[model samples]
Structures are given as C-alpha cells and as structure tokens.
Target: MRSPQGVCLFSLNFPPEPTGIAPYAGALADGLSKAGFSVTAHVAHPHYPEWIIADDYGQWTRTEERGRTSVRRRLHYVPRTPRGYRRLLSELTFGLRLIFDNWRYPAAIVSITPSLFATALVALRLRLTPNRPPLIIWVQDLYGVGLAEVGEGSSLVQRIVRWIESSTFRAADHVVVIHERFNALVTQELGVAADRVSVIRNWTHLADPPNTTAVQARRQLGWPADVILAVHTGNMGAKQGLENIVDAARLAEARNSSVHFVLVGDGGERKHLESLANGVSHISFVDPLDDHDYHLALSAADVLVVNEKPGVASMAVPSKLTSYFNAQRPIVAATDRAGITAEEIFAADAGLVVPAGDPEALLSAIQSLCADEQAAERYGKNGRQYRDAVLGEPAALAKWSDLIQQKFRDSNQN
Candidate 1:
C-alpha cells in the first residue's frame, strides 16, 4: 500500500548521531510514522559527539528506511569552533541545505529545535506555498533564550536571528515544549496562544528492553561494588553546567567518600572537563557506549545525574532526564528546585535535589544517598514508575499522533 500524503519533519539531529537531540528526534519520527503519517525526515549528515562527518554517509544524498519513514541526508557544514561566528554559520548552512528537501505538500511541517534555520525555511515555504500547511514546532530549546545565555542576544546577528525565531513561532500552528516553564515563555513572552501550546516530555529512544540481566554490568565496567558510582550520561556541553560535577568530584575525593563520579559522554566541553580532572582519582571519563552497554551501565550506577547551569531553568529542559528515568537509578539533580529538571525529579520522588553549581551541596546530597541504600532504592523505583506513568513510549507516541493528525482535516487533503 502506498503511504498517504503526510508530514514533513525536519530536525538537526537524527539517528547515527550520538548524544544531544538525535535519539529524541528519531523517536518522534518513528512515533509519527506509527501514527499513520508518512514521514520524510530531513537531517544533515551525522556529525555529533566527535563533530566530524563520517566518510561514508552523504556521499550523494543518501536515503534509508527507518521503520515507516524515509530519511534523507544532505551534506551540510559542521564547524569545528566551540562557539562564535563559525558555529552559527554551520547552523545556517544546514538550514540552507534543507531548503531543497522535497516532499508532497505535507499537511503540517513539524520541526524539532536547533533546527531553527530549517524551521524558518519551513515558514518561508508556507509563505510561498498556496495551502499554507500548518507549521508545528516542537521546541527542544528556545534558540532566542539559549542564544541570550551565550551572550549573543545583543549582537547584530542575534537581532536578526530573534526576528526569524519570532517569525517561525508566529508561523507555527502549534508549539510543543517539554516543560511548563517553556510553555509560559512561548505563550506569555513570545505571544503564542496558551491553547496552541503542549507540554510533551521526551523519552528514551532505545528499541530494546533492558537486557543485561544476571550479568554484573558494574563489574564488567570495572566499577567496585563497594564504591557508590554516580554516573552522568549524554552531552557534555556548557548548558549542562558539568563544571559543577568536576567541583563536586574534587570535593568527594577531598572528603574521601567511597562515592565516585563517572561521566559517560563527550561534547565540546569534554576536553576542558578532562583538563580539570587531570589529577582527580575518583573521577573518570568513559566514551559513549552502544545502547545496550549504555543502558546497562546506567542501571548499574548508584546515582544518575542531571546538572544545569545557573539560571538556565526557563530556557531548556534536559531531555537526559527521560533517559535517566529509564535507567531506573536514583537521581541527583544539582539544579534549582524551581527549575524544570528539579521539578520533574521532585514530583516523581525519583531523587535528591541540590542547589545548582554548589560543590558542597552536591557532595552532601550524593553522600546522603550513598549512606541510605533503602532510600536510594525507593528513589530508583519511583523514577521507573514515573517513566511508565508519564514518559513511556505509548504515552508520547499517542500525543504526537493526535497532534499530527490535528494538523489536517481529511486524509486526502494533504
């Protein structure tokens, strides 16, 4: 049977790209496909974690099947700079590349953020097209606020970028954010109607259920059973406020607690973080693992971590929390209690929350959990239960299905 005229979904990150938004984007695509929309996913060539495009992909506009959807990769720039003009250029370059990614007039254009340029292109396409298919933006990060975090809001480039962001939000028929905080920003601050916004949290993308049963994953990874392993998985970027983890690691070692800090992922700040931990005995860094190993390792850890920079509460919600919930480990979120991450963790009764960027407070919280096995176990259980209740695949997919179909009146319209 032929797939119906469906949705054009564009995201900057997709499968084959490790960390960041890839897993979330890919999961959403599959969910939409399962909802009966023929999805054509437009993504730039994979270049994440290591920030180098693999030689084999995008040799000539490669196309591949991902369940019911088809993904098209276009060669786009991946700049080496950690920040500044070059990085912005890379984002814009990919956006420009997406302009030609063709599809039937999709009932709706759904874009996941960091796809700002591509999303703007969608707005422009709506302007050019006759039907003006509804543009739906799932904002994983509010670029305007995030750019301001990096001190880019005052720049001329940011001025133009914000204008485009406003246009994209204005063009969107519906706006999705993972947190209520963000919903408020998009509605009250950005002028999107409250009724048009939806808060849908992200979920783990692993296809397989937990499988490392009976094997001691910690022993396999050389972690001592006696030591309390506090593991943080996913991107090591500025927004993560991982410097606090480094400081907390130093404090843990100085106090000589059996608690050890393990960071299992890489990104722009990986090099600098390594430099900070050069002589630290209790802190270690591991490369990103395949899904099985990563999940098993996370499940084995005594504590899972979510850290965010000071004052980043309203700007972004760490999607890593969904993965953390899947890991079913007691969480230690060293962030503002009022922030989205802390709110979720607290509501789920999943973990302990400490003040953001406070080494002593983080150390105290880790030690508290390490001392009470029963409390930690309860927290872990709570997190797993919360994932089932809220962030599970069925719930997320159902929401997307309704939203996607809502963009069109009739099946034949698109």
Candidate 2:
C-alpha cells in the first residue's frame, strides 16, 4: 500500500556513481525523505562517468533502504563506448526495465534526465494511466540542445530528438530547471508553459575543505610545491572539450612556464585525452578522489578550470562549479564567450573567460592569474560570497519540499 506522503523518483543515476548528476539526484532523494516523504527511487546500477559496472554489483536486480528512502536498482546495458547509438541502446534497455517493473501509486513523481529517453518513456506511461499523479521533470541537461551542440547526428535526427524532448516535457505537471537561462529555452524553444517551470539552482554538495595551506595540501597529495597548479576536475567527456586543456598544457611546456595542469576525474574521453597529452610533461591525470581528497585537491590548486566544447552554450552549467565556488579557488573558464557558463562566471565575478578551443588564450589566462595574486584572491572571494548568498542548501531543499507538498495537496483535492 502506498502511503499518503509517498513520492516516486525516477533517476538513471544515483548514489555510488560519485560524479555528474548522481550526487545531485542522491541529495534530492535524501532531502525529500527528510521533508517527510517516503521516497522510492527507481535507479540503474552504478555505471556512469567511467561507464563500467563494478563486479560486486553484478546482480540483475537489487533493493535496499537508505534512511527513509527505498532504493531499487535495476540492471541495464553498461555501454563501454557510450557514443550516440550505444547510449540510446543503454537508455532503451533501462526504460524497458522501468516500464515492466511494478510501480506504486505515489502522491507525486520526480523524474531526472540525462537518461532523457528513459524519462520520456516513463512520461508516456504516466500519460496513459487514468488519474496519474503529478510529475516534476527535473532538467539536469537539455537533451535536444546537447544533441545540437555536440553535432551528434544530421539535422533531421536533431529535429526528432527535439520533438521527443518537447513531448516529454509537455507531459510533466511541472518542470524544474537548474539555471534561469533554461527558462527561455524550455518555454520558447521546447513549448513548455512558462508557469510550469521553476528555477532551483544546484548547491555545493561537497563538505568544506579541511583547514590547511596550499603547501600542506600539495605535500599530502604528492604534487610539486613550486609550480603554478591549474586543475580541472570532473568528467572528461566530449562536451567537456578537455583536449583544449592538453593543448594549453603543451603550450605551457613549450614556453617553459611554471604552470602544471592536472586533469582529475574519469570519463569516456580520458584515454583520448591521455593520448593527446602523451609526452607532455606539464600535464598529469589523477584518478577520481574521495570526498576529503577531492576537496583537498581543489584547495591545492592555484586556479580551477572549466572547459567546454566550442558552441556548447545552453546545454549545461557544469555541476563542478558549485564545488569550485565552495573551494574558494579562482576559476578560469574556456568556453563560448556568449554562453551560459561565461555569463555565470561573470555574474559571480568568479574567474576569467577565454574563447573555447583556444589553446594560446587559455594558457595566457592561466599565466595572468599566476602573475597577479591579488586579482586571483578577489575572484575566489567573490565566488564564495555568491555561493553563500545564492546557493544555500537548506533554501533550495525547502523549495523542493514545498513544491512536493503543494502537489500532494492538489492531488488529494482532485
């Protein structure tokens, strides 16, 4: 029997994935649970950024409880190479499992995307059910915009993807977007009603860094203490355009500069990026770190970096930015000048912005920051201030809780 305060959440990524959308989804589930909702999250096995499932989690199906939430993990195709077609296959496999699984009628439903295809399938199922519960489709990444930006397929394919995305969004009772910029895109481009969409910015999920100097952090991590360390953390994917970082590192090496580039985290493109940086002594790669070490690495960096593929503007705002802000480290973004990322950095006064895919310009920005300590300090301070004022965790979670309660009331009324 479904409880009055029960909420169903569909997320392809969940806890143990450790990067990208998983952390945010996990946080939301926990927040909802704490708000007195019984959250039953239907999720896939932990295969993300790395795209490989662990040996111990080889089960076809599993169920577990975490605090007030019940987690059901389903087996899906773990694509070794998550290209366009293979990725679709993976989502299709997950969606088929979800469609066949027994579902409890909850007060409301929350669905997250990135597995946009799977979410759309679930949305279609809800539409056909009589007296379906209200649904909030969380927009983590805009699928159609991502397809267009990445140039994955032909124009016809892009149009079809947009149509699917639009239909899925329109089926939702309400839509939650992480950035204000997504409002126009959702309402105008995707044809969702303006009133149905709300912006709830993502908050820093990482714990505050340990109290230690950069020198201490460097020593602990075994990194050189005498270099200007520029670090980029998170997934090294196609959209990330991490090759630009490799090229910039090459430039720094050629100029005999003190800046050393560290690419942290794993993804589909890590091998490709490693190949690109082969024989480039200025660049190094670090495996994904635990919570404490992750925070420590950020604290040790002289400049934190965000890199995006050329023309990837509206598709996403890097999730890493929230943690970067919390680290109070100066950032340097190499992305489209007119994109949402540059706008965000500019708004927070967080860091420098250079054109995407420009090796020389990126190198120059890093060198400039290394040369000016006061300016770097100011940028870091501004970012921390912005994070505290705009991205408080309690406020964001309360908004979500209120939305769920209101939806439940509306459902009960009908």
Candidate 3:
C-alpha cells in the first residue's frame, strides 16, 4: 500500500558527503519531509568528492530513518580514478542494482541526475509499471553536455549516452533545472517540452561563517598570514580543470609573487593535480573540511576562485559559488567567458571572470584584486547582497515543496 504523501527520491549522492550534488539532494529530501511528505530516498552508500566508500558503511545494503525520511543505501563500485570506462562501470553497477530492486508505488517520484544511467534505468521500469506514478527528474548536471565537454568516450559511446539521457528526461512528467540556461538545453538539445521544465536556483547549504578575522582564521588553519591566500574549494574533477590553478601557482612562484594558492577538497583528479604541483611551494592542498572548518576556510581566503576546463560551458553552475557568495568574499572565475559559470559570477556581481585555461590571466585577476582593497570589498558586499536577495534557502526549499505537492495532487486527480 502506498502512503498518500509518500515520495520516492532517487539520488546517487546524498547527505554526509559534503560537496557536489549530495548536499542539495539531501536538503530536498529533508525539506520534503518537513513539508509533510514521507520521502524514501534510494541513494548510494556515501562516496563522492572522495570516491572511496565511508569507513562505517561496508554492507551491501542498509536502511536508516531520519525523521519522516527513509533512506535506502546500496553499495556500488567506486572507482578511485573516475574516468573513461571505469566511471561508466561504476554508474552501470549502481543502475543495475536500482533496476532490480523491488519498488513500491508512491504518490510521486523524483530522480536526481549525474547518476544519469541509474535514473534512466528506473525511468524505464516506471514506464512499464501499471498506472505508473509521476516521475520528476531534478537535473543538477547534464550528462550529455558533460560527456561532450570531457570527451571521455568515442562518438558511438557519446551517442548511446545521449540517447539514454534524452529518453530518461523525456520519460519524466516534469524536469526541474537549477538554472534557466538548462531549460533551453533540455528543450532544444534534449527534446523535452518547454512546459515540463522549472528553474529553482540552488542555494547555500552551509551555515554562516564564524565571526573571525582573516588573520585569526589563517592562524587557526596554520596558513601564512603575510601572503594573499587565493582559495578554490570543492571537487578537483576533470571539469574543474584544476591544472590551471597549478600553472598559475607556478607562475606566481616564478615571479616571487606574494599570492599563495590553496585547494581544499578531493576528487578523481586530485592526485593528478598534486603531481602537477609537486615542487610548487606557492600551491598547497587541504583535504575536505567539516562544515565549520569549511566555512572558516572560505572566510580566510583573500579571494575565492571558480575554475573550469576551457570547454566546460553549460553542464553545471558550480555549487561552490553559492557558498562563496554566503562567505561574502570576492570571487575570481577562470572559466569559459560565455559559460554559465561566468554568467553567474557576472549576475551576482561578486567577482571577475578570466578566460579559462589561462594561468597568466588568473594570476593577473587575483593580483589586481589584491592591489585594490576597495574594489574587493565592493565585490564581497555585492555577493552577500545577492545571496540574501536571490539565493536564500527558505525561498528555494519552499518552491521545491510547493512543486512536489502540486505534482502529487495532480497525479492523484488523474
């Protein structure tokens, strides 16, 4: 028997994994539960930004309850170097597990992507079910766009992935995109109807930063206080193109620049990035920090950075930007000039955008900000204002709750 308010959420990542899509998906599950919906989240065992399973979770499957939310965690193959065939295997293994699992019909279903294959498989299952429930796909990143941008597989592999992605999206009763740009991409490129998409921007999930000076924060983190610290947080994946940071750090070292670069977080590309930065004194790496320390790390930076590969344009809108905004710090984005990331930084009026893959340009922007304290302060103020006005958590969550409820009501009526 299905609970009238039951909502089954399929997300590859979930809470306890601090960065990437996990936090947003976790927030949605919690928000829906608070809105009086019983949300059953079918998620993978916590293994993300750091692609290793959590130490505490060794079981093949486990179930836990958090208030009104029921979480089902399934173990999947996690590749340390998540690229090429290995990455596909990981997604396929998880998707197969989800497809074969016994499912209970719910009032509505919500699927989060980046586990695009897993979502598609479940979508196929839903299609065959009698009196199928409404499926809503919440897109955090476009798999088709990512495959093309990363150039991971061959042409045939790309086509298969795109076919799977478009089919799954079209199967959904509706799609929720995080940005307006995604609407056009979905409708035009992926063959989804315009009316089926909704845009609810992602907000900062991190708590407010501590009341501490940058000098004090630096002291606590053991970072040098004299130099200007340029921090880049979040995933060090291929799309991040963190090699640009290494190159810029090398340039700074060559010129004896006072700027120090710090990368805080881990990902598939972290090892490669560290290799590239092996002897570069100007660059340092920090493992992922807890919430309090994460915010402190963001607050301690003189300038926060958003870096992407040159070709990565519209796949995602770096979730780190929301946290950066909440930190009230000036941002310097090294991304495609016409990409969604650059557009976001421009919209927030929070930072400067430099051409992607250009280390000299990145270094120049950081130095320019360092030289102009007033300008940096102005940028920081603008960011905080934008966060409060546009990226507030209450607004985003409320919109999601409303959408889910409306969809549930509509499904029942039909």
Candidate 4:
C-alpha cells in the first residue's frame, strides 16, 4: 500500500441523499481537500427516502461538481422492491459500476457500508492490487445485525453475507467504528484485533441557526400556538420503532388534545404510520423539508424525540441525535444511552432518557418537559452551548481533517 497525493472516498450516498452520512462524506471530502489532500468523491446517483433515482439525474452516466470538493457521480440500480433482497442487488450493482468507474483513478479505497453485498467486491479489489492504497472500512452499522433486523434474506444468506463482512473487516487496513460500543462489538463479536479499530463520532448537521422566530416559524409551518409540538425527523424504518410515537400521541391526545405530534420526514414505514394516525386530530405529517427549512422547523419544536428498537442500540449510532442536540432543544430519547444518542443528550444535560420502545416512558418524559417550561428552556440552552463547544463545525472539521491525514500517513506506512 502506498499513499496518494490525494484521497478518494467511495460512498453510496451523496449530497441529494438526504441522510446524515451524505453530508458527512461531503464535509470530509471538502475538509480533506482544504487540508492539502486532493479529494474525489465517488458517489451513486442520489435516490433516498423514496428509493427511486432523483428526477434530475435522469439517464445521465456521470456528472462532476465543485462545491465542497470534486464530486463524481456514478449510476447504480435503484431497487423497486421493499424486500432487502432487491436492495442488496441494488447495492452490489452500484459497487460493480463503481469498480469500473474508479479503475483509472486509482487511489486508497476508503469505503463505507451497511451493505455487505459490496464488501467482498471492495475487499477483492484491495487484495488484488498489490500496491493498493490502504482500504479503510468506515462502519456505521454492523451488516450481520442490520441484515437480520431488516429481514433482507434467510439464515444461510445472512451467514454468507456475514462471511463477506468478516472478510472485509479482516482485510481492511483500518476499521473505523462510530462509537465505543461499536468498537467493542468488533472486538468481542467479530473478533477483530483491538489495535485495528478506532472510534470516532460522526458530526451533526447543524447549519446556521434558522433566522426565524419560533412563533413565526410555527405559524409559517401551519402549526398552532397552543399545542406543545414534538418533532421526529429522519428515516422511517422498522428500527426506528415510530409506533411508539403513535401510541404516545394517543396518550397525549387523551390528556390534552392540544398537544401535537409532528413527523417531518419520509421513510419505508411512513405511509403505514400515516395510516395509523389517520383519525388522530393531534397527529400531523409534513412533506420533507429542504435543509434550510428543516433547521427552522426544528426551532419550532418544544421537544425532539428519537426512538430505536431494542437490540438496535449498538447496531447504529443514530445520526439525527447530533442535529437534535445542536438544535438546542430538549431531547426525549427512547434509545440506549450507550450509543451517541444517549451520550450527547445526557452529557449536555439537554434532555431526558427513556428505554427504547417504551411508549409510556416516552409519554411521561414528554409530559414532564412540557409541564415545566423553565426547565426545558434551561436544558435546551445548555445543549446549544455543548454542541458549539464540541460538535460544532470547527471542531468537527478539524477532527475530520486530522483523521483523513492520519489515514493518508497510515496508508503510506503500510
């Protein structure tokens, strides 16, 4: 392995992906370039939430952009199935296309994944290239757990996928996990060498504070002044356990019909969730907001809530929690605190924590926060201060620059 004068990032998601990692990869690419390493982002056509390719990228093979850094778009199949099987095919198809697309622009391979279907391809690419730049596997979720949770395939299929996942982890020059719990999962469950793993929290998506008053923002968004609004914005997947929110909403509506529960995002389960909330006057759903509007919409919330299914604790460090923390709003986290979700809110003293999937607990915490306005404001302000000091742009950018540089040096040493 040898270092390049530049770093190339291979990520499936990019700018229009509308998820946490899209912006993160973009930021890293930009940061690496500004830190004196030329950067290229190899990304698939952006189609997220709805799982259909964006209308703007129609029939185009590739496009280059110079916003944060040089971005290279590649075409990949967008799965039309809800089953994880077709999704796996889509991921593999993208990886195959990426291999050919990146063939001439050889550099170190720093790939990310929840898709084990592509792990073997990436591992084989690195293994075959004797002078390959180090392959750093940036892990967000464990493929073994994720596959099982999503019901992607059968037991035998998962076993094979797990083998692929293990092979990639074993072959990778460095394995970076997002949290300490994940690092432990690698060492204890996957039997990875302790020295090969590193833990780094992904930064939040807090942009400039939206220049709108809470009242004005609420009015503009068609929200009422009397209701205590609880906002949930992110992926709508089974792992989110959003049903708990519906249950909590029912309980809250029973207590004070004025309280409103707002869901502001798209996901696999969103339509079903909407159906369940059909007759509930207090439940509201809105189309996904653009980045700027999203920030402003969050400002109107009295509390932010995040829910994770049981056993999904270490599998994912929910990226939305960072934005919630940075929004300076009290968080009602229905997730394990061991993950970054708990760490951010608890450390900042910004919100209350409850066990995952417990509607009653979520209801109680929401009630507690709503009941005490002064306490909620204090917690929210402290959270903003904590985010600025730790997870803000300057700190996040510096840390990302250092790690990419470290990867550059680590590759050279290898």
- State each candidate's clash count: 0, 0, 0, 0
Ranking by lDDT: 2, 3, 1, 4
* C-alpha-based local distance difference test score of model 3: 0.90
- Overall lDDT per candidate, in order of appearance: 0.79, 0.90, 0.90, 0.75
Instruction: Say which prediction, candidate 1 or candidate 2, comes out ahead on lDDT.
Output: 2
Which of 3 and 4 is ahead in TM-score? 3
Of 1 and 4, the candidate ahead on lDDT is 1
Q: Model 3, 134: alpha-carbon shift in Å? A: 0.8
Ten contiguous residues minimizing lDDT sum, candidate 4: 101-110
Predicted candidate 4 versus true structure: per-residue lDDT over 228-263, tens digit per residue:
888998887778888888888888777764567898
Q: Write the per-residue lDDT of candidate 3 for residues 1-414, one digit (tens) a residue.
A: 556788888888998899999999888888888888888998899888999998898489999996678999988889989888888898888888887876677888898888887888889888888877788999999988887887777888888888888999999999999999998999999999998889999988877778888998988888899999999999999999999999999999999999999999999999989999999999999999889889889889999999999899999989999999999889999998888998988998999999999999999999999899999999999998999898888899898888877887777778
Listed in order, each prediction's TM-score against the native is 0.92, 0.98, 0.97, 0.91
Worst 10 residues of 2 by lDDT: 1-10
What TM-score should be assigned to candidate 2?
0.98
| Model 3: per-residue Cα lDDT at residue 246 | 99
Off by over 4 Å in 3: none
